[model samples]
Target: MINVIIVPAFQDNYLWLFHRQGSDAAYAVDPGEAAPIEQALRKHRLQLAGILITHHHADHIGGVNALLQQRDIPVYGPLSSKIPAVSRPLADGDLLTLDGGEISFRVLAVPGHTLEHIAYFNPDEHLLFCGDTLFAAGCGRMFEGNPVQMQNSLQKLADLPADTTVYCAHEYTLANLKFALQVEQNNPALLARQQEAQRLRAANQPTVPSRLSLELATNPFLRVTQRAVIEAASAYNGRPVDSPAEVFAALRRWKDNF
Candidate 1:
């Protein structure tokens, strides 16, 4: 009975708020600012129970101190010293139960965008709060980790059940889909996804929380082993990119410049 609500923050950031259906206690994920989260809480008539941080990025944890000043709630995050506000430091494979044990999540160490990044997955609910590690059709920039780390991180996510709903941290779907088309032009699934994303954007709606199956079909980053993606990455690098990690690196570089 856990329900998630999207609380739009900065230009493209999306802060997630989740609570049980009949409960007023709620938790926020990647709340970069307190104002919007507070507003959302008031709007939903839910009280802040805790906070969840995936990485140490400012845009993801900027509001943690401010929120703590208002309410002394536990802050759960990766086992990194960078974010000192994390009261409950978690590691890979740690199981966290919240809301009187009605909601539970497994911590997955998905370091790529940042060396300390992690993701939360609720197996029973088929939900993934992946922060900036994996996006709708793209991924975060390699600010700290290398290609191998990112590729492995993405592979871990790809191994999740196909029905998992990806709740990434940004609103980069349309833009990512545009780049996906450049790498896999003949993919009808990508084309259809672009059309659907365009339609959603035209109406000023969010295109996040996409199914993992859709991402597997249309996301170039997740399709690094595909022939079309490999060819495109090789063409971009002016050399044959054989390994999946190499293809992922090339695609990431292309998107960085795109």
Candidate 2:
């Protein structure tokens, strides 16, 4: 059994610490800073065995060198010149073994937020550590890849099982949900989700790792084919949305200013 610990970082970033239930060996995912990760390791009495980088963003790979200074562990990340300390440069379909085969993840190239952004997917575990490609009721802004590429990447993720738990790298659920509700005002699922998210935030709790099932039903970005979402996106764009990618682009741009 693997226990995933959420380490809150600068502003809303979430640095994931994955470890076996009864073992000391652990892997850090997208650790933006060293201090929080170091503190978590000491608090849990865990060993830093490896690190997983999802992208080359400063907020995601900033702590790599500092953590390496503490312990020289293998860094598994995309093959990008921007990200340093990547001893194991990975690509799509690459199988990553960590903790002596105790845990395995399949690399998926999900470019949208960044050109070389990747996700670690464990089919057996039904988990996806997607950096910024897929969020809870939201998707990342297109920084490097175009709308078509981002839509395709999101489609790949949407094809996964509905039970897959998405561990996004940020705590943008509430803000995303606010925009989602605007796109789907009459959707009971979105309204209910808004209520639930409000409760979680009121308690100062994290609302991440949302199941794909819930997101499929409520997330506007994933529901481009749906009539309501298409209508909303079309209205917002002041034009007809002929394709899923176009709808996704309209919605993304709408969210940018929302």
In order of appearance, the predictions have TM-scores of 0.99, 0.98
Candidate 1 residue-wise lDDT, 1-258, digit = tens: 789999999999999999999999999999999999999999999999999999999999999999999798999999788899999999999999999898999999998899999999998888999999999998999999999999999999999999999999999998899899999999999999999999999999999989999999999999999999999999999999979999999999999999
RMSD of each: 0.7, 0.8
Q: lDDT for each of the candidates? A: 0.95, 0.92
Error of 1 at 185 (Å): 0.6
- How accurate locally is residue 252 in candidate 1, as Cα lDDT from 0 to 100? 94
Model 1, stretches more than 4 Å misplaced? none
Give the clash count for each candidate: 0, 0
Best by the lDDT measure: 1
Error of 2 at 175 (Å): 1.2
| lDDT of model 2 at position 222 | 93
